[model samples]
Target chain A: MAGIQKNISPTHIDILKEVGNIGAGNAATALAQLINKKITMRVPEVNIMSFDEIIDVVGGPENMVAGIYLRFMGGIDGNILFIIPYRNTLNLLDIIFGEKKRDLFCEFDPIERSALAEIGNILAGSYLSAISSLTKMLLKPSVPALAIDMAGAILSVPLTYYGHVGDTALLIDTVFEEGENLIKGHFFLIPDVDGYDNLFLALGGV
Target chain B: MDVVKVGMADLKIVKNPQIITTLGLGSCVGVVLYDPEKKLAGLAHIMLPDSNNSKDNTNKAKFADTAIPYMIDLMLKKGAKKERLISKIAGGAQMFDFKGKSDIMKIGVRNIKAVKENLHKFNINIVAEDVGGNYGRTIEFNTNTGKLTIRSLGKGTKEI
Candidate 1:
């Protein structure tokens, strides 16, 4: 397998950033509608980095987090991850269920877990749909999987998929915020090594 | 004592009075080989089961098959005796539950199996193991004491 790192150029990065922007914009709008709160998203940052660096970007190896993972296929195959810190997860749960019953370290009930998964499903669907419409590529996302654990552990699952081909991953990252209540979350779009060519090609990159 | 951090798909060797660590191992396995008599240890955070599966095998520490033999050679060069080497392993967790039977979902199990097979190839005894759960782990291997400290969120900390 050829390394994606050798072929990535500044133009490729710009295209990915644009993808993140459109995708995250749609996701933010979907989230706002879900919670009925005004959500703002930062301009997405596209980075090609090692697996360790990607973990650090989310927080750290041991940092407690709630992660939603999904795999997308069709014109392009890749993984999309949504990460929120523990406190932010609590705040999000509070808003979604309209209650503050769960503590910081408490286990989530079956309904709470399903709620989290549905949120992931919506966010991933919106994000991928935006990209699909923009590039005219058919993209289908798998059923969302939710895991509340260490950032390193959760990210390692996706990193292993990329590990077979290369050490570095191209990450399109976007952060979402909901004002002073501090409902911040990070969204990462990681396309596989072989998928890069198809992605850049679909975007009309030479 | 200094703590040497091993990044993902990386490996490190430390002598007495030092600690070697790898963080947040989800479906990845952290393999620790220690020579208690020599007070030396090596830690490798391996991401995949085999190097032959990938065309890019340049990163030896990234796969279980390549990494174990590489660490063994390094430890031997540093005066660690092969006969005294024992293994302590942790990590290799599912992390998330996926309903489908995709190969990716079984990576943790595959990683653990590959690790055990590699260690066995080197004739190293696996003395202790805490693996195959749906949680992430941060592992620190202390060379001086030949102990592996595994810490997981909400799972409590334990040493073996």
Candidate 2:
């Protein structure tokens, strides 16, 4: 497990701080379309630490969540992590799209999937494009997977995120307001070496 | 071709141009079933893996175990054949940082499991599935062609 290095890796942290600042800014741009309103995203709180540290602060196991994980390849290759609590997702959507007569997450409706996907898509694209400008690689993004809940499930594998600073997980706090709803969306940057390396392979650069 | 929205735990059936849809999936599961011959497709979004654990029907769509059975029964009542029917599913993303410590909200994994169980109970197989990840998936089903398209953020649209 790589711990945070203050002396030897200040440069790495600096680069990531810039990365996150831009990523959050871009995410706000994407949200503007769906909600039809301007989004305000604050500068993300960043840290560099091991996986165990993540489990400590990220609520608890039973927390229902929504997330988008994308593998950036070549020009800008890494993990782009984004998440929000389930209840907040609906509340945020309701705010952006106006009051829904039905539950924002009415299970049988797939329309919300598109709405959420659009949000994730634009954020990832914006983040990658920013990174690509720096890395000079054509950043390609993968699909967004939104997990509805985690009741009655088993831990089968270790998951890594690449949405952080200086080899550490990057954490962000996003604020969304459309109408009467003000919702917060949290973003994480986990370092997924496997996914990153996969991108290298995809472009025949691996 | 009327539009019917299915609630979390509930089921809806329609004939001739009926559009049934759902909103955000996050880690929840979307189960879409359609019979080409009958031109009937029913979509259910279930939260948890099983309803046996929940005594309340309110969260029916939140759990796969309960929602799968509930959806299948609804289809049966609408005169869809068990063997003639096939299913398509999407949405299951790991949304939070667990640091691999606990599988608490592996809801995506459990949702898939419950869909499998309930489908098995009725002898129906999932023809296709788009699942797992840090990304959210959106699915659209056209009963006319019985085609389901899954759109993942940044991943583009894929027909399963």
Q: Pick the candidate with the highest DockQ.
A: 1
* TM agreement with the true structure for every prediction: 0.98, 0.46
Docking class of 2: incorrect
Cα lDDT tens digits for candidate 2, B48-150: 5654554333544445666666666787788877778888887666654343333434656766776777787877778888877755555667777777777
**Tens digits of lDDT, candidate 2, A1-206:** 13223232444445555656666676667666656666666665556443324433344333445655555555434566566666777776677566676643456247776677667777778767765665456767666544454211111112322211122333333333334446566555443444333323333342
**Model 1, span B1-160: residue lDDT tens:** 6989999999999998999999899999999999999999999999999999986889999999999999999999999999999999998899889988889989999999999999998899999999998999999998877889999888789999
**Candidate 2's error at A179, in angstroms?**
9.3
What local lDDT does model 1 show for residue B47?
Answer: 94
Tell me the spans in candidate 2 whose CA falls farther than 4 Å from its real position. Answer: A2-8, A55-58, A95-97, A101-108, A150-181, A193-206, B1-160
Residues A48-135 of candidate 1 have per-residue lDDT tens digits of 8888899999888889999999999999999999999988988888887776765457888899899999999999999999999988
Docking quality category of candidate 1 according to DockQ thresholds: medium
Cand. 1 Cα-lDDT: 0.91
Calculate the i-RMS of every candidate, to one decimal place: 1.4, 15.3
lDDT of 1 at B133: 88
